[model samples]
Target: MMIDGWAVNALPGVLVVPAVAAALLAILPNYRATARLNVMATTLTLICALSLFFGKPQPGPYLLVDDLNGTFIVLTTFVGFTTSIFSASYIGHELEIGRLTPAAVRFYHTMYQMLMFAMNLALVANNIGLMWVAIELATLTTVLMVGIYRTHEALEAAWKYFILGSVGIALALFGTILVYVAARPVVGEGVDAMVWSVLVTRAGAFDPALLDVAFVFLLLGYGTKVGLALLHAWLPDAHAEGPTPISAVLSGLLLNVALYALLRFKMLLAANPAAIAPGPLMVTLGLLSLVFAAFMLYRRRDIKRLFAYSSIEHMGIITFAFGMGGPLANFAGLLHMTMHSLTKSAIFFAVGHVAQVKGTQRIADMGGLTETHPVLGWSLILGVVAIAGLPPLGIFMSEFLVVSSTFAREPPLAILLVAGILIGVAGLFLRLNSIAFGEPRGPAAKAQASYVPMFSHLALVLVAGIYMPPALVVWFQNVAGLLG
Candidate 1:
């Protein structure tokens, strides 16, 4: 149960080691060596992550590895590994295209590892303050990567991401302090006051007023980072302008991590019977983002931006499921989160290839993809189908559960949910059909792409949809119960 003097705290240290090595490797003058080192380091991190899964849950004041975070740790590492592989090819092309210099690529690789570290730290941290710090670290790392291209547009996107992300994290920290203030009265001041387990156990005794105010700030703060609309101004630009691998990581991993932090606070609020209901706020925002992004999807001119909007829409659905706060709803939320992460990343992977092959990011210029690159086109089609919530894909299963749960509790909201899904489905299919079935529109495509990561993600999404292993269901069920 214990690997270090800290007793069972070893998992966290294992997570931190790669990030630390990555930081050290960042300063190396050799780009070739750094790139290979980056890949090797990420591979090692993935191995450690897999090893961590077999260990028993380690509960403590600073860190823990229960079923809830254990699943996330695996998901994070899996996505990280895939993204790193994709990045190697994508970045190589960028270098050839002169889109990135050797120095910038070095910085990108360095920041990439730092981002991985921050995400892992956020997932494992048991203390609220430390969790906030981890989220901030992740935000900073991504901001640098967002602007790596040094284009006018890229710089603008990075600047906006930095400003908005900083504001969001600041508000999150403020919220964290308020939670501590509320908890101090119940758990007493000092480290225990900010310990997640301690706060959850003593939540009922904390002042409801303080918890209410704190949740409001926390929701807006983390919701911004979660890419919820109204406050989601930063997300599309970040996704569209940034490198596609970073786009995949942002959509597939970082947003979920921010939302996880928000859900943890939501759970604390749930434990406090006297506190104001967090459901209405989450439901309202979820509905807003879903509705907003559904309409916005139709108007996207850029391929990447179009999929970025889809990410926003899917995040909204997950939020709505969690807001419903029933056993089935929460379970659906957990499943939706996983599916969206995999499906969205796959979509971006396909997008990256398409953009590179066609030599344009514009949606209008790229048509009849199937005629040119059948494999990439089919992959894109599969990805869009899975993401559009079509049947037999994991997303459809999750969306169905969400709608069914909403129908049981709130039929009117269920109607809205269906409407959003239908809109998204139509938009995606229309766009996909145009892109995949028409004549080849641009220069003949000819670049070898490692399709394993994209296809592999879609395959898993398919398997999870038709037949979720019982053990996985039990795992999510336990985590969902704990979340509430």
Candidate 2:
């Protein structure tokens, strides 16, 4: 089969290359060689993902590819590739400081590839069951990596993630089973009931009551992984304690993967008119998350944890956009999701370098960054501005779209959304000014890491804000229409 012109047969390579590279890295003891290999494997995987835009494989009972997930695959692999480059430099510094042994470095590289493989599988899998398994695998790999340093805080964070993550997986499993049971009557008790494409087509005929129950379970379950307000206890801790590269992937890629799963199931629910509207539930949670995280941002002492809350706030906005469920709103949601992924990852990249140079993660100890390290300081300032939803940034455009759309549809909710955004902006600038200006509080050494990945992401976001390519705009609009 062919899509835009490319052969569908190439799809498998995207999955296979990472799995093989991971195995190779597992056995290799040299940190330098394994690090280079990680970047190569991720780059190759990204190439395969990009090829999918040219052509896609036919959907099957266990695997599928379409405009919606095709977009996700590209974004996932691209961020994964950039993060690998950043990781190479970040990990090298850790080695020099004796914070990581050669063995741990090898293991970290292997697990990083494994996490990439699992995320790719989750995005491409056609069966809900397969997707669940893939997400669980990704979670496991991240948990191990988070605790790689074996520090007390690292272990505690990993344990929290594992416990909370396991509960989420179990809830999602039950929801999946309930969905199968709902479909069993119409599609029969077999593989057909588990297929996403098949389920959506036959959704109107399924028991609406059962779907309502299943959706609640699925939302709460996967919502945990999405870092939604109440279930988000694991998020800040994980970001604070894990390696910065892992934190980058967690915010930039993994949360989006979980939300993608929710969107798929939401599409199924929307297909059946008899089912309860999923919009209200999603909007409530999204708004709650935004407000809650915005308030919590003021209390954070650690730089990573502060941005972790920022992640929760942005995810809330994206979730709200999706939940609003119209062509304009959906398009805005997609734009916001893309912008947040790029911007947050870039912020983490800057934070990683700053922490290394200052020898601290404490916000109090990180003053006068601009005076001490102009490039790193200014890069971080740009990232902060973009994330604060300031003008001439991709995030500002997306947030503007969201608020305008919400106002046209729901005025009161729009007010609350604006308030949340303003609140978050206030908190971010307050901390940012302190970090980027003022007298230097701690020793500032020159950064050893490459600035290419961080600056590259910021540049893309800046250009996207100024001028969105016509083809890309059309692609997002097409997918937005599909969301309804």
Candidate 3:
């Protein structure tokens, strides 16, 4: 690939802008100015990401771009931009109510930009070691923000996330080293073996045994961050205790970044005919997470935690779709990933507004939302319905594709997947009815949130379901083929 002049400059800007904004935000002191800067920086980054579609820098030892990651780059930056908008309004409320001090607000904005920078770096990275470093940077930034409240529960959640995230990072590092070792014989020693473009092109010649062991480590390691069932202990607490903006970004963008790393490896393994098939492991793990999260959903008392489990379930669906490894399944997986990101973040935006108005995160305390706060209530209802995979919504279309593709490939597994989806629907609607339609409970002060960001996401998702652009379908199809 040849580098265009515009892409050479633009690609670096995607990473540089957020980092510069973070440094400036740390010393700014004024909440309003810092917040606007956050939005502006994210907007610029999103523009850079979109520009990659027209032109891209040449692949290098440390950085690369392709159809697969190009899509992720756009999705990550777009969500980051909208979430920053939502965060500005959301955090301002916290400052008003004394939930956050000005210093904490500065710290939060700085970390937010840092997180965006890290995720953007991770998506664009070509070297396995560089990618690992980027992911760890993101984890640390989020850990700090998760505990920003300084409450006992917030601190504990941060601690748990830190410990689990450290273990995952360590395992991922080991896996990356093993991969370098595996590729060293074919690609030679040092950086050449670590570059993703080189590794995928040469994977078929590498030793199968080393690749197999390395993949096991990689999947378990990154899957932890992806919130696969047993490794998801930290997720609910992190979502429940953190500022809702962090929760939104965690579910929307961060998990997708981790999964993107795993998918890159999956492609490498798939290229090697001698290597063990990667699908079975991902399929098993995905199903386990989907079913486990679905059953767990009924038990969540915290509203944030409820949606957090929903994120896990949807991730499992995406994983399962990709693991199925066909044109249809891969397309579905891509669509599902995009839909879940938008819908889940929109849900958190609504939930944040609701928490602000009601002054609580407890679901038991929130009832009859339609009566007291119709906009928030109805918005939440639409978000919940879309997430539950109701028809004429983005999730419904993506999930339908997943299920239909699964049935064509394996009937028994399709049944299990459907069962999980239906169970999740029941649990969500049960909660939704109480929250949106019953007698009004708790204080119902009118929310002062910027409804634009939340509704904007929901509107996009709705339009996507009704009709996907031909260009997007072709793009997803090409990437799907690349996965196999």
Candidate 4:
């Protein structure tokens, strides 16, 4: 198989641009220039990611591209680019309000690019160990950003994220080592033992017992990063205290990358017949997270935190869909993952601006949003509707597929899923009713906001619900087949 010359440049370019931007932004003193540079860097990185559709390099010890990761790469880069655009205006206001100093803004942009580099590396790495390293780097970058403000609460949130994230990655490392041990006898030493492409093809010959234990460790480890039920305590705080853009990325990008790593390992498990079926474990955690997060939503006081738990619920649905592991379920899982990423991020963007306009994150303080500020209010309504899995939205289509697929296979489990989703729907709309209608509260002045990024995402979600492109459906179907 021959690789295109341009494809070779594109993969390296995706990483190099952000790495270079992070270095450059660190030294550049002006906040305005740095913001523009952040957007430009992500834009260029997105271009490189897009170029992979033309041609891709062969699998190697260190990196590779395939249909599975190709979808993630494009989604990651596209969202990263749009979020950067939103960040420019969002952070500018923070600077004016003195909430963020120039130095903090500089560090923010630098870390933003660094986070992009790490995520892209994780997506492209062919080595599972190398993928772990990339996720750890991403975790570190976000941990710092979560606490950037240095407030007591911010520091506390960051502290919790760091401790939990560190433990999660450490467990993930143990799991990675167990895999290497299993593969060593078969693949024989060195980097080959840790390379994903090699592991999947050779996994059947490895020790099944070792592989089984390795997956349990891997699931618990990476599941933490995915914000599964028992592992989700750190997520809400991190979202509530971090900058809005960071909240958007945390919900939109980082969690998805973590899930991507889990999916990679899940594929490895699927290749080994004697090993434990990974689906049961995933289903348990996914169902648990969905139910727990749904009930938890009613208790949130902070607007940002409310959406944060919503991220957990949506991720649960995605994990559960994939756990079912058939053509319909996998296709539904793929679509839902993409939809959740877009819809959740769009919600954060609106919440960010809403917090800014109202000067508070407390839900009790915000009321009559639709009457006072029509654009942001209605935008928030659309986002909430999309996220709640309402009809005529992308999430609705994907979720319909998940529920229908589940009912055909497991009626009891389907009941649980439907109940969880309904409980979640009630909680979210309860919050929405108060936030978007009736008596106005607090400041009602016009908000200086970035509507393009928010509206653009919403439009895509709307279009996706109405009609999925033929190319995308084909891509997802092919990838679903591969997941088996």
Candidate 5:
């Protein structure tokens, strides 16, 4: 995983590979060729991201690679690479089934790479302004992809996402400006005022009033992107109507990217002793999102939509864990976020095939899946079992830590958290029963594509649940300590 000489340049490669690939895919003809090229480009970007471990780069005026973001970069690229593999098979079927056109898929491939580039740039960005630009770019790319199918539902979802996402970005931009203004007096105007590293070092002296207001806006803004409750209306529709691959990225990567931005600001607020404690605000929203999404999960009929709510609930858990900020809680939050991404994306992979095979996403239409397609059926069941915080799964370990830490520090909040988790579990298993076992219903046609990606992710989740490498434990512990 380590790289030696010349690997310092790998930082640029993470951004450059996807940017270049997007350009090439824009004109590339033929779905098969474009798809393989997409995978290759993403693989190269992942290699570049991994190299950051040994070839750590210095903080710069515009971009930097460091411990915290280095982990995020690697995860983002790895998932992007795997999702590309799934997208190839999924979209190929879409073409054959007339759900999409060759032209539409060409556009989809181009936007996919563009989205990866934007997310990478956001992660590596040293400047707040640059990060804002990168996040906005990523949002715009997903907006386009969300409507690629051009169905009425798809278009409506895209518009909803765009409108909501724009408002979120606007609030975020205002917060970014406030940060710069707060820093300008201390750090002296220009770019240095907006550099994230610079802001953290001098934040203690920045006006606490401005910092407080800035954080309020920043949380709501980025929380919208994170799909937190009260600000999460666009997420389910976007996930339900978009291509399944896009849904996977929405939950697995984009939400985390938004949370990353929010965490950076939380760190800034933490450095200032005079500023208000951010824990209460995040805790409130996190709990609200958890309870809210947990209840909403029962109302979902579309399979994709069901899991979309599950994502909101899991993000709530992660947020609540971080809001409770101790080394243990932060560590739990980080672990839960990673586990959720891997597990949820794997679910979407199975869900994608399930919807395709059954020719519908309606839960009522799919029954006796174990009898119909054992691999997909069981893979999805295992995914849900993992996501439900059951034992012997990655999420179980993370959720246990979250609940244990909460109980130790704040007993009442632990009760509420447990309530939400329990409700979510009941709702998910209720839905699972209808889909996984029963009298056969819907088409049982065998899937055309091999589901290696789905199984591979599940295998990782299984192993993580049982045992984690010492290196990963140390890495998460170090990052958790840094957050404090």
Candidate 6:
């Protein structure tokens, strides 16, 4: 690789390679060829993201990575790679059912790569403007993918997503500009005003009022995209109408990316003592989403929509954990975010297979998964346990930490949190009992389902719950300290 003089801290091939590869995928003649290329590109991208762990931290004018985003980079790429593998089987079935066309398949594969690139760029970005642009690019790509089927409902969902997302992105940009203006008085103009390292170093000297106002817009803007309640109208419809794999990515990956963007700004606020407290604001929004989504879960008719509410609920919990702003709570929040991403996406993988086999996504129409398909049945049951915060799963570990910490600090709120968890558990078990235990209601339609990826994820979640690695503990400890 020839490095430009300006690219002194150039990565060997991380960004440029996958970007160019996405364009290559767009013109591939056949679906088979394109799928192979997509997998290769995703795998290579994962390698690049992992390599960044050892790559030199380049705190420059536009892009850099230290401990802060390195973890997110790994999480994003790992999930991206797994989702692409799942999409391989899932998309073929959609095409056979005439839900998508060859052209659409080409578009989907190409967009998937672009989304991957944008997410990676966002994680590594030093400039706040570049980070915002990368996230917006990712949002647009997913919006296109969501409505790829071009159904009436899909089109409606896409339009709604576009409108709401546009507003949110605009607000975020405005907040970003405010931050730039805040920094310019101290750091002077040029790229320095937008660079995260420079901003953090000078944040203490910036105007408190500017930081306060900027955080509100940033929270509301990115918070909208994070699918918190009140602003979450776009979420369920998107999940219900889009392809299942895309639903998994939107819920698992996209939400995390948005939350990450919020945390970056929150760190800036944390650096300024005179700035308004960011904690209570996040705590309030988090609690609202938790309560709102919990009640909403019991009313969901569509299977995908049911899990969509669950995603909202989990995101709220993670946000609340972070909002508490202690080392233990922050660490728990980080763990929960990672675990939820894995478990939620795994559930969707099962849902996709079940939906394809049964030819329906209604909860009422599906029953007796054990009799019809033991593999999927078991997968769904395990996923429910994992997500509902049952023991011996990663989510359980994180929730335990949150509950214990909250009990010490605020017992009443902890009780409320537990109530939410219990209600979610009952709903999931009720749904699982009907779907996995009863006699098979739908046709016993077999699929070329790949259990390797699904089970692999659950197994990892299971292991993480029982025993988190020491290295991971250290990593989260470092990050949790940074969150303060």
Looking at candidate 3, what is the lDDT of residue 358? Answer: 93
**Candidate 6 TM-score to native:** 0.96
Misplaced by over 4 Å in model 5 are: 1-4
Clashes of each: 1, 0, 0, 0, 0, 0
Ten residues in a row with the worst lDDT in model 4? 1-10
Error in Å for residue 480 of model 6 = 1.1
TM-score of 3: 0.99
Segments of candidate 2 deviating more than 4 angstroms: 1-6
lDDT of each residue in 1-484, candidate 3, tens digit only: 3446777888898899999999999999989999999999999999899888877788988999999999999999999999999999999999999999999999999999999999999999999999999999999999999999999999999999999999998998888989999999999987899999999999999999999999999998999899988999989999999999999999999999999999999999999999999999999999999999999989788899999999999999999998998899999999999999999999999999999999999998999999999999999999999999998999999999999999988999999999999999999999888888888999977789899989999999999989999988999999998888
Model 4, range 1-484, lDDT digits (tens) per residue?
Answer: 2448888889998899999999999999998899999999999999999989889888889999999999999999999999999999999999999999999999999999999999999999999889999999999999999999889999999999999999999999999999999999999989989999999999999899999899888888888988999999899999999999999999998999999999999999999999999998899899999999999999888899999999999899999998999999999999999999999989998998999999999999999999889999999999999999998999999999999999999999999999999999999999999999989998999999999999999999999999999998999999999887
Q: Which ranges of candidate 3 are over 4 A from the true structure?
A: 1-3
Each candidate structure's TM-score, on Cα atoms with residue i matched to residue i, is 0.96, 0.99, 0.99, 0.99, 0.99, 0.96
Segments of candidate 4 deviating more than 4 angstroms: 1-3
lDDT of each: 0.88, 0.94, 0.94, 0.93, 0.94, 0.86
| Candidate 5 structure quality by residue, lDDT tens digits, 177-217 | 99998999999979999999988999999999999999999
| Candidate 5: Cα lDDT at 202 | 94
Q: Looking at candidate 4, what is the lDDT of residue 116?
A: 94
When summed lDDT is taken over every stretch of 10 residues in candidate 1, the lowest stretch is 1-10
Off by over 4 Å in 1: 1-10
TM-score for candidate 5, residues paired by index: 0.99
